[model samples]
Target: MPALKLLKLPPPVTEEWEWQMNASCRDIDGSLFFHPDNERGEAREGRVAAAKRICEGCPVRRECLRYALESGERYGIWGGTTEEERRATRARRRVR
Candidate 1:
């Protein structure tokens, strides 16, 4: 069998993203309810979608996302983005 790969959970995320991620997912089963028929493969996508909505209604949402992206946060929820999404974004912005 191909070696079982272990996907890292990313580095420590900022307290703000952590709070938003947890908070948004608190009352709602964001994994399932927030986005209907959400497959695990699209978990990150779901988080991003949910994050936008949460940010729209949040007071310090921009600040939180700014802190996350500027600091190169590589973890759970950051800047209203998932680890994979963030990596892809940064990669594109890299000066080749």
Candidate 2:
């Protein structure tokens, strides 16, 4: 063998996207977004409300909502919107 050459590959890309920005719920318990199936009524409402509050203050709320809608996310609170709210958004989008 006369010579062997190796080509260096560029560094792997690790830039964060807008959707990957720090979230307000980063410090919150994930369980709050995915409450127990047995949880109902006032308890569930309180949990959902708390999660939504975090989402309300999130800087990437719109991106979060878009991600949720595009992914067809059917569970948990996202972008301060409940599953029912997201359903309405989808319906409205379809009408447009």
Q: Please count the clashing residue pairs in each candidate, in the order shown.
A: 0, 0
- What is the per-residue lDDT of model 2 for residues 1-96, given as tens digits with 9 covering 90 to 100? 778788999876655344545778777788988778788899999999889888887988887788889999998888788888999999999999
lDDT of 1 by residue, 1-96 (tens): 799999988777576456555444356544432333434556746656766665456555566566766788876554456667667877887955
Pairs in clash, predicted candidate 1: none
- For model 2, give the 10-residue run with minimal summed lDDT: 12-21
- In candidate 1, what residue range of length 10 has the lowest lDDT sum? 29-38
N/CA/C clash count, model 2? 0
Candidate number achieving the greatest lDDT relative to the actual structure = 2
- As a TM-score, model 2 comes out at 0.76
Best-performing candidate as measured by TM-score: 2
What TM-score would every model get versus the actual structure? 0.42, 0.76
